[model samples]
Target: DTAVSQTPKYLVTQMGNDKSIKCEQNLGHDTMYWYKQDSKKFLKIMFSYNNKELIINETVPNRFSPKSPDKAHLNLHINSLELGDSAVYFCASSQDGKDYNIQYFGAGTRLSVL
Candidate 1:
């Protein structure tokens, strides 16, 4: 089984709409993160969670939020989505929220806002 999995592998929507991407990890990891990959393929960290506590929240718009109800799950919610929000969102997790720790990533959710 995949260590990390994200639902709605492909999402195509219009602007000004709200949407969410669900993510889950089965690796029993204590740290989870949300990342966004733009058209140029640069991955940026959006949010990070360790043992259900928010940490390392990057400079993202208020429209974006990471909801972590538990240690194994961290979902991303985007409100009033804009055209610029179109990109691939990835969910990742590691054994701990420590530097140099190897993180396992999901296939990614491709979001297209037309």
Candidate 2:
């Protein structure tokens, strides 16, 4: 079984549309995160959720939201998506209170906005 899984592996949409990506992890981790990879392949964290609490990254725009319905799931929602929002979104999970710094990542959802 996949440790982390994301739905809609590929998404192509026009500008000004709204979309959501769902994520789930079976690792029983306490910490979950959402990451975005730009066209240049620069990956950056957009949000982190620990035990169902939200922790947004300062640089992430308000349009981008992370929602955790439970410890095993984290979802990403984007409103009025723009061209710049086109990127690969990754969901990750790790054990909380650990110094291991290791996170398991999902296959990623590639969103393309035209």
Candidate 3:
């Protein structure tokens, strides 16, 4: 079975709408991350959480937030969506919040703003 999974593989919403992408991991990892891939294919880390505690928040816009209600789940919530926010969002997990650890990635959620 896949270790990481994301719901709503494809999301289409208006510019002012709010939406969320849900992610869950069954690998028993303590750390989870949210990453955004822009149109240019540049990937940036948005947020990181360990054991449901947020540990890293990168330079993402305030409209974008990561919420982890438990160690097994981490979700991304976007407020007042915009065209510039359209991109591929990925959910990843690792044993711990370390770069050296093997990270498992979800199939990714593609968001489109129209």
Top model number, TM-score: 1
The residue pairs that clash in candidate 3, if any, are none
Residue 41 lDDT, candidate 3, scale 0-100: 90
Q: Candidate 1 vs. truth: CA RMSD?
A: 1.4
TM-score of each: 0.96, 0.95, 0.95
The candidate with the higher TM-score, 1 or 3, is 1
Per-residue accuracy of model 2 over 41-92 as CA lDDT, tens digit each: 8989889999999865758789988889999999999999999888999999
- Model 3 over residues 1-114: C-alpha lDDT tens digits? 988999989999999999999999999999999999998999888999999999999988899988999999999999999999999999999996465878899999999999
Cα RMSD for candidate 2? 1.1
After superposition, which runs of candidate 2 have C-alpha atoms over 4 Å from their true positions?
Answer: none
Please report how far candidate 2 places residue 42 from its true position, in Å. Answer: 1.2
lDDT of residue 25 for candidate 1 = 96
Q: For candidate 1, which ten residues in a row score worst on lDDT?
A: 95-104
Q: Global lDDT for candidate 3?
A: 0.93
